[model samples]
Each structure stands twice: as C-alpha cells, then as structure tokens.
Target: MNNYEQVLVALRRVIRATDLHSKRLSKTAGLTAPQLLIMQTIRDLGEVTIGTIADKVSLSQATVTIILDRLEQRELVYRVRSEKDKRKVHAHLTESGGSLLDRAPQALQEEFIRKYQNLQSWEQNMIISSLQRVAEMMDASGIDASPFLDVGPINRDHEWKNPTQRDDRKPDPASKLKAS
Candidate 1:
C-alpha cells in the first residue's frame, strides 16, 4: 500500500482501538468516557461549575449538560446552585460516585497521556506537532473534541429506522441520503 493508504489504515486502527476500549469501559464501569471524565474532574476540582468542567474537558457546556443529565440519572453526581450566586451551579460527586470512581479503571486517554508524559520533552512535542498537522490535514483544526478518545455509543447492529418511516420528527438531508 502507498503512504496515504498506510496512514489512513493506521488512523482507522487507532479509532477502532479507542472505540473498543470505550465499549469495554462502558461494560466494566457502566460509565461512558465523557461521564467518567466529568466525574474525575469533579473529584479533582472538589465542587466545580459546569462551565469549568466543560472548559477542562474541551466540550461545550451543552454537551457537558447532557452528559451531566445521564450521570445524574445514574445517581453519580448532583448539582448545587451557589448560595451567593444562585445563577451559578456546581457539580459534586455523590457517595456512590466516589465509590465507583475508586474502583474504575483509567481512561484510555489517561493511560496514553501518562505514557506520553513519561517520554522526553522533545519527543512529546514532536508527537503533538505531528498530530496537530494530521488534524489540520483532515480539516479538523479547532473542532471541539475532548482529550478523551471515546466515540459515544456504538451501534454494531446497524439497527436504524428510516427517517421518513419514523412517526416522530421532520424529514431532512439524512432521509434524502437513505433514499438514494
């Protein structure tokens, strides 16, 4: 294969590895990578605002909020409005959240980062620069992505319903693609 094909295959393998680990993490800990990252941040920050969590994780506030909803449903976290500033809210891990965290395995990114940090400074810089170049080549520069590499839920079954056939929501571009 050519250099381009090799690089594409390598990238695909990396993505597949990340996706596989994410599924394993979900099965083992019952927490998505984003959810686990949020909980870890809460543990690190000791009561942090949702905005702070979003900033630290490189996700939008809206995305964080949606993840927070899932975590809250699982009883992993609770939000409290600031006493002095009711408009502001902070996230704290629940007792069970803390217990679960103690037993949870390290995230894939965390493992990679730990190993990366152990490398020489120059080596680290080289990898970062190369990855940045790759991102730019793919037109993904400045796109919002968490440090964590987990692709959200995987649907291996490809169990999808046609948009036009659905009883809910309006038809759009995806339906057109399906028709073709």
Candidate 2:
C-alpha cells in the first residue's frame, strides 16, 4: 500500500477503536466517557460543585452542567443549593450513581493514559508530535475539543440500533441547574 494509504488506514483504525470502546461503555454503564469521568470525579471529591468537576475533567462548566442534568434525570446524581450560600450549589452522587459507577469500566482515555505513561518520554513526545501533525493535516487542529474520547452528542442518549426502532432511553431535558 502507498504511504498515504497506510496513514489513512491507521487513522481509521484509531477512530474505529474509539467508537467501539464508546459503544462498549454505553452498553455496560449507560454512560459516555465524559459522564463516567464526571461521576468518578464526583465520587472521589465527595459532594463537589460543577465548576470543580469541569476543572478536574478539563471540560466547560456548561457542558458539565448539561451532563449532570442527564444524570439527574436518570436519578443518578442530585444537586442542592448550599444554605449558607444559596448561589453556591453542590453535586452529590445518589445511591444509583454510586452503584453504577462502582461497576463501570474505566474511561477510554484512562486506559490510554495508563499505557501512554509507560512509554519513554521521547516516544511519548514523538507520539504527541505525530498526532498533532495529523490533526493539522486533517484541518482539525483549530477545533475546540475536550479530552474525552467520545464521538457523538454528549448530551444525548445512545442511538437505538435502527432508526425506526423506538428507544425507551430518550434524551433527558437539560436543566438549568448550577450543580449536579
């Protein structure tokens, strides 16, 4: 195969791998990578705020709020306004959230990070440089992206197998909540 064809094949494999992992995660935990990361952060931090979650996961606060809204609708997470400061709200994982999180698999990026850390520094830098170059070649370098490895709309439920098939797992309405 030509060198450019080889590059295209490699890129396709990477995209396919990410897509497959995402499907596995949804099937197992009913949560996307970002959702799992946010929930894990919430569990670790013990009743944290959305801003804190956004910072921890390197996501926008608005995006975090939207995910929390879906989780809240699923009865997984709860939000409450602090009595001392009504403006400050906190997020806590409900019983269901904790249970689901306990059984959930690690996020795709977490697995990648684990393997990435083991590589020599030079190898890591080379990989970073190569990936950045590929992004530039694809005109995707200017895109704003979170660190999560998800591919679809983060706020929507996983699509059903067939477009004509009805899914009970409808997308939740986004709540204008400052927490959860």
Candidate 3:
C-alpha cells in the first residue's frame, strides 16, 4: 500500500484497538474508562474537589459531574460539602470504590505512558511530533481530548439497537463507504 493508505490503515488499527479494549474492560470491570479514571484520581488525591478531578483528568466540570452522578448512584463514591465552605463539594472513594479500583485493569493510556517513558528521548519526541502533525492535518488542533481513548458504547445498560435503526443517534459516515 502507498504512504497515505498505510497511514490511514495504521490509524484505523489504533482506533480499533482502543474500541475493543474498552469493550473488554467494560465487560470485565463494569466501569467505563472515565469512571475508572475518576475513581483512580480520587484515590490518588484524597477528597479532591470536582474541579480538581476535572483538571487532573482533562475533562470538563460538567462532564465530570455527570460521571460522578452515575458513580454516586452505584454507591461506589460519596460526596460531601466542605466543612469550611458548604458551596464547595469534594469527592471521596467509598470502601466499594477502593475494592473495585484494586480489581480494575490499568487504563490503555496509562500502559502507553509507562512504555513511552521507557523509550529514548529522540524516539519520544519523534512520536509526539508526528502525532501533533497528524492532529493538525485532521483540523483537530485545540480539541479538548482526554487521555482516555474509549470510543465504544457509552451506556452498556441501554439495550443494544441496530446502528441503522437508531433514530436518536446520527448516522456514521463510514457506513456509506461500506455500502459502496
């Protein structure tokens, strides 16, 4: 294959890897990547504010709030209004949360970070530069993306429906390519 085709294929491989791994993790741990990330962050930073977790995880406060809502429903985490400031809420892990976290697998990005850091300085710079160039080429510069790369289904509790039959969701652009 030519250079362009090769690049596209490689990109597809990366995406597929992330998607499949995310699905596997969901099935095994019953937690989405973002959920696990927030749990880990809470454990690492004791009784952290929602804003602090948002900053550490590179997610918006609104998004973090939604995830926290779900986690709270599951009884894995608890929130408290700061004693000094009732307006400031902080998240803390429950015993269940700690147990779940102990059993959860390392995030794909975390594994990648460990391996990447082991690489020589030149190799690391080259990879980062190439990825940045690709992001610029795709017109995705300044996009607010977290290190979490799970692109699979977000809500596993929702019944699975055919992609073509989902009226609530937009059509996938690649479906046309597959049709042709």
Candidate 4:
C-alpha cells in the first residue's frame, strides 16, 4: 500500500476506536459521549448555568441547553431557578445522575489523555501538529468541534445501543502503532 493509503488506514482506525468506545459506553451506562461529558462537567462545576456548562465543555450554549433538556426528560438532572435572581437558573445532577455517573465507564478521551500525558513533550507536540495538519488537509480546521467523541446525534438517548451485540474487547491495538 502507498503512504497515503497507510495514513487513511490510521485515520480510520482512530475513528473506529472512538465509535467502538461510544457504543460500549452507551450500552453500559446508557449515555451518549456528549451527555456523559456535560453531566461530568455539571457535577465537577456544581449547580452551574447552561452557559457555564457550554463553556466548560467547549460547546455552544444552545447545544448545552438542548442536551440539558434531554437529560431532564430522563430525570438524570434538574434545574432550579435562583432565588436571588429570577433570570438565573442552575443545573444540578439528580441522585440518579450521580449514581449512573459513578458507574459509567470513563470517556474514551480519558484513556487517550492518560497515555498522551506519558509521552515526551516533544512527541506530544509532534502529534498535535500532525493532527492539526491533517484537519487542515481535510478542510476541517474551521469546524467547531467539542473535545468529546461520539458518532450519532449529540442529543441521542441512552436507549440507542443494540441489545443483540456483544463486545469481545481487547486493548487498543492502535495505541501500539507509531507513526514513522
């Protein structure tokens, strides 16, 4: 295979890894990647507003609000109007939300982060620059993307996983591959 073909294969592997993890998370915890991330942010920041959650997750306020609406419907979280100000509202994870979060698998990025942090500073910088160049090549440099990874609709519910499928899991094989 050519050099370009190898690059495409590596890119596809990264994408497939993300999708597999997302499906596993959905099956195990009944939450999409975005939903889990928003909930985690809310829990970390406690009683925050929609804008705060959005900013913390690098998503738009409108996007956060929509996810909040879905979470509220699932009774995973609730919002309260601030007594001191009628114009203000704060989001809080419900008891169910906290419990589910405790049991939910860590986000795919968490594993990548753990591995990434162990790399030498120069190696880390090289990876960043290479990925940035790839994004630019794909005309995706200007796209507004949050940090989390999930393939389906951002507002999709926990019931999105397939019941018939089973995972015969293994360590991420891609992690062992090095760019030449």
Candidate 5:
C-alpha cells in the first residue's frame, strides 16, 4: 500500500479495536461506552448540567440527552430542575448509578491503557500533540479547541494523558474512509 493507504489502514485498525473494546465493555458492565463515560463525568463533576456533561464527553447536547433518557430508565441517573433556574436541568447519579460506576469497568480497554501508561511523560505528550495536530489537519481542530483554551495547555501536567480521561473513540472505518 501507499503511505497514505497504510496510514488509513492503521487508523482503521485502531478504530475497530476501540469499537470491539466498547462492545465488550458494554456486555460485561451493562453500560454502553458512552453511558459509562457520562456516568463517570457526573461522578467527577457532581451534579453537573447536561451541557457540561456533553462537553466533558465530547458529545452533542442532544446526544447526551438521549443517553440520559436511557440511564434514567435504568434508574442509574436522574435529572433535577434547577431551583433558581427552573429551565435548566442537571444530571446526577442515583445511588445505583454511583455503585454502577464503582463496579463498571473502565471505558478504555485495559490493554490500551496499560500500553499508554507505560510510555514516558515526553513520549506521551508527543503522541497526544501529534494526534491533536492530525485532528487539526483533518479540519476537526475547531470542534474541541475551546476546551483546551479554557483549561490552558491541552496536556497540562499530563492531564490529557490520564488513563481515566474519557476520549472520543475514533470514527468507524466507513466514516473515516468516506471522510478521506
């Protein structure tokens, strides 16, 4: 294969690996990857608004709302109307939700996290910066730029390298090739 094709193939493999991991996590934990992610965010932020959760998870507000609905149905989470701003709603994990999170496996595959964590700090930073640069080259730079700016350096003190930080999964092969 040509260089470009080889890169595309590598990217597709990574995407497939992630998808397979997510599906396995869902089966084992009774929560889809996104649901586990949102639950973890709510646990970390403690009674955060829908928009905040969406931003944390790199998903749209509407998509978050739909996921919240499923979570609510399962009694894993509930929404509360803000007392001071009734129009605004915040999502909070139920007792069950917290327990679920405590027991649920991490969204990232164990093997992926293990390999990622073993990298030296500089190596980790380099990989992250390279990935971000590639995202920008692909015209996705603007999508999450505000978050990096709002929080200062994108990889501040290795925050982005945290194993617990929920990252968006790579696009499926069909979508990636179509974009290419």
Candidate 6:
C-alpha cells in the first residue's frame, strides 16, 4: 500500500482499539467513556466547574454539560452554584457516585500507563520526548486546530475557593504531500 494509505490504516486501528475499550468499559462499569472520563476528573478535582471539567476532558462546554446532565439524572452527581460567583456552577459527586467509582475498574486503556511505568526512566523520557516533537510538528503545520492550543490556557483560572484541586501534568499534518 501507499504511504498515505498506510497511515490511514494505522489511525483506523487506533480508533478501533479505543472504541473497543470504551464498549468494554461500559459493560463492566455501567458508564460510557465520556461519563467515566467526567467521573474520574471530578474525583480527582473535587467540586469542579463545568469549564474546568471541559478542559480536562478536551470537550466543549456544551458537550460536557450534556454529559453532566445525564450523570445528574442518574443521581451520580449534583451541581451547586459557586457562592463566590453565583454564575459559576460546580459539579460534585454524590454518595452513590463515590460508591460506583469504588466498584469500577481501571479503564482498559490504562494498561498503557502500567506498561509505560514499567519502562526504564530513559525509555519513558525518550518516548515522551518523541511524542512531544511529533505534536509540535503537527501544531506548527496549521492543522485546523482548536482554539485552546495547549493545556496551559485551559487551566488559567486555577484559583478556586477550595484551593485543593491541583495536579500536574493531538493533531494532523499534511505532507507537501510527502518528504519528512
């Protein structure tokens, strides 16, 4: 096959893998991929605003809102208006939500994390550096990107009243149609 076709095939495989994992996760956890993603984000950053959740999940606010709606309907989470800023609404997990999380297994894709952790330090750094380089090249190519260029802009409003939420830590390119 041609180079372009080879790349398409590889990407298709990646997408398929993610889809399979999502389905499996749903069956095992009773949570869709997005729902599980939101739940994990909320668990990690207790009482977070919709904007923060959207940024964490790399989704639009409206999309996150819909996910939140479904979660709320299931009584998995509840929202409360920020007292300091009434306009802002924060999502907090319910008792049932915490219980559900306790039962859910690590996401299937998390195998990558475990495997990566087992790698030698230099190997891990090399892999991360290589991926960062690739991401930079794609970004530089003006690849029909989103407004938030990187994760930095997404979390600028980091100072929440609780002050406890903190943790550290995509794209295409066209050849001249070739030659890399």
- By lDDT, the best candidate is 4
lDDT measured at residue 69 in model 5 versus the true structure, 0 to 100: 84
Residue 102 CA displacement from its true place in model 5, Å: 1.5
User: Better model by TM-score, 4 or 5?
Assistant: 4
Better of 1 and 6 by lDDT: 1
Q: Sorted on TM-score, highest at the top, how do the candidates line up?
A: 2, 4, 3, 1, 5, 6
TM-score of each: 0.76, 0.85, 0.81, 0.83, 0.60, 0.59
Q: Which sections of candidate 5 miss by over 4 Å?
A: 1-9, 109-180
- Once fitted onto the true fold, the runs of candidate 4 whose alpha carbons sit more than 4 angstroms away are 158-180
lDDT for each residue of candidate 2 in 11-69, tens digit (9 for 90 to 100) = 99888989999999889988888888889999999979888998998888988999898
Model 1 spans > 4 angstroms off: 153-180
lDDT of 5 by residue, 1-180 (tens): 899898789878876776666556656666666677788889999979999988887777887898888788778899999999988899999998898889877766445668989999999999889878878888977764422111222222211122454455754567778887
Candidate 2 has an lDDT of: 0.86
Give me the displacement of residue 99 in model 5, in angstroms: 1.8
Rank all candidate structures by their lDDT, best first, as comma-separated numbers: 4, 2, 3, 1, 5, 6
Candidate 1 Cα lDDT to native: 0.81
10 residues in a row with least lDDT, candidate 1: 153-162
Tens-place lDDT digits, model 6, residues 127-146 = 87865665676575444333
TM-score of 3: 0.81
Better of 2 and 3 by TM-score: 2
How many clashes show up per model? 0, 0, 0, 0, 0, 0
lDDT of each: 0.81, 0.86, 0.83, 0.87, 0.73, 0.70
Q: Is candidate 2 or candidate 4 better by TM-score?
A: 2
